[model samples]
Target: MSNDRFSMCLASDLFRVKKLKSVFVALILMFLILFLTFAVCWVGSNLVSKVEVSETPSIEGETAPTITQEEKDGLLAALDSVINDSLMGSGAICLMEFLVMIITCIFVGKDFSNGTMRILVSRGANRVHLFISKWLTMAILVVAYSLFALLVSGILYAFKNDGSFTGYDFGILMRCFSLQLLCNLASMTISLMIAFLCRSSGSALGVSIGLYIILSVALSIISTVVSLSGGNQDWMMFMPMQQMNVAASAGSYSTDQLCAVIIMPIVYIAIAFAVGVSTFVKRDIK
Candidate 1:
């Protein structure tokens, strides 16, 4: 069993599977939801603007508050939060990560549940090579989807902003995307580890989602405690998703913060990948 030959065969076969095809469709649908949500909000705001002219009746006793320049600027800033490219890109990446988790559960968990993994091992395939190939295939999918989501997000933002999306810097968008991708790759690693280890699709799905929720709540609590203790927020840069969100919102990061963001995700992905591969290699399959 040549490692390269077996890995390629497995990757190719996995790509052609109906389950994988459905994953792609799910990704597309998720993207569409993001795009349509922005479009609908834009249209709804415009309709509300038109309706306010005649329907907003003036009361004889009450005077409306005067709109100040500072207030107007604040409102524009808030609007920018919703219609900005960086925020949209971050949102799309997050949504795709959730979709990928589901796909990963189906991809690896089903193989174990159906005894396909054991059959492949019995046929003389190298376990290490199999793990590496599977990781590479999922990585490719993530990179491709992340890039597409970023582009779609930028286009949608451009349409919202009077068709001038290019006014925003591409470098900023790329930086945000890079941070988001790192976090997503880490998420993929965790998902793959759980799926491969569980050996049951339903259990993998439940565990993965449960773990995410627990982590989120735990991190939030940590952040709150740190804030109340008057500790410097520099330490918060270690939180992967928080770092990614900061990158998206700020449109840039300092050199030290960027290094931390990049290093943390890599450390996580490496640990999970190593553990999953080591365990799978030693396990007996009937």
Candidate 2:
């Protein structure tokens, strides 16, 4: 196939994939999740601000303590902290990413089960190209979703804090987003690999959900146990979701721990892609 023809085919496949009902549904669900996250952050920040103000003592001569510039700055900072904590913490954004990963996996796995892979490959498409294209599409979706969530969360935080907008913690927000993106990509890749390996969407979905639950819930418990037992909790650094919280906070993590968080997801993605492509290349797509 000519280069131009292959490019056209790739574009066509992407367009069709984007129009899938599942894609629309996933995007709508993402918007709803973002709304809920923003609402929660707004309420939490307001509550925290009220509590802080009530607890602060006024000087005897001070008349009801009007809002000074310093106090406004403090409130802004406090609101930012609340917003960051609620949106990027283990409970909210992290769980949303996990769900997105599962949805992406379901879409990819369904393509295989429905014989879409056979159709795409039979149309003069290389297996590796097809795999990469699908992966790229999923990456775009994840990034778009994360950015939307961040924007909504920021807007909600600002609205709740007063009508004034304090700038976001861009570094922290980006770091949190990067971690979530890596986790989603790794999870989706793993699910695709499982689908290719088993040649069954049902098996792939089951394994994907099982792994998500185990990694997010079960492993966390184990990590806490190890930490309480005086064992080095260093291994938890490699868990993608754990790193998401660590990175979202303004506090610094050790260089080694940071490196592990960055490296582990890349390793997982590479391995999953390698296995997926190898399997796709050798398998009989009937």
Candidate 3:
């Protein structure tokens, strides 16, 4: 494609998404859900956490009230844990995925619903370019949402801890969040494929949500059974959501585990886009 056409396709896709009221609604709704999850975690921590009192006696018979080095390390570790949970936990990632599903489903499925895609193709708009533009647009939105979530989590952490960021590894947080973003992209692609196949926003949304529920339950049962049988659940690592959820706490991840985390989602994205785009190019738009 020429550079001018390429730019136009991208610009058109972005503007379309930007004009969708549901996109902003989905973003706000997803963020609220994510924030509530963290808020619950914070409240539960307060309920269960114990206050550590130093044992050293002062001249006036008061406890020193100073935290020991070990306690400080523990606090820092706890902070890191919260950050990870916020970024890459199953709840957070799933919420992000659902948001992607809604946004992409509407964005792509609407074109079919309104006969816009058919009109575009009739006017010589390349089907391949349209696919690429929509894919890239969804990717941009997913990554932006992930980054915003990370920022909000960081802000809440600082507010809760008096603005202290000590010993919190921003590097590791980014890496794990990057993994979640990859999963988000793959999930978006899956939803997009369904949108293309179904070609109706409502059908695509319903199918995607139903599949999500079924897969979540099935994976949980399988993982539990494997663990109780003393069998390794390493196979679960190849699944995008599982990989995204555990990545944040995988302190001793093997190189192969890391590779799966990165590679599996890319594989999903490639396969999904291949199917979605090919069908889109050949299938009759209704």
TM-scores, all models, native as reference: 0.85, 0.77, 0.82
lDDT leader: 3
Model 2, C-alpha of 176: deviation from truth (Å):
1.9
Ranking by TM-score: 1, 3, 2
Estimate, for each residue in 33-118, the C-alpha lDDT of model 3 and write its tens digit. Answer: 66776676666556334445355522465454555456655765675467446645455555777778888888888988998888
Q: Name the better of 1 and 3 by TM-score.
A: 1
Alpha carbon deviation, residue 209, candidate 1 (Å): 0.9
Per-residue lDDT tens digits for candidate 2, residues 96-188, read 566566666666777778878777778877777877777777777667766776776566556655765544545556666676667666766
RMSD of each: 3.6, 5.9, 5.8
By lDDT, rank the candidates, best first: 3, 1, 2
- The CA lDDT of each predicted structure is 0.72, 0.67, 0.76
Error of 2 at 248 (Å): 4.7
Model 2 vs. true fold: TM: 0.77
Q: Summarize candidate 1's per-residue lDDT along 69-172 as a digit string, tens digits.
A: 45445555655566564345545667788788778887878778887778778877778777776777677778888878877877776677677756455666
Pitting candidate 2 against candidate 3, the one with the higher lDDT is: 3
User: Residue 236 CA error for candidate 2 (Å)?
Assistant: 1.8
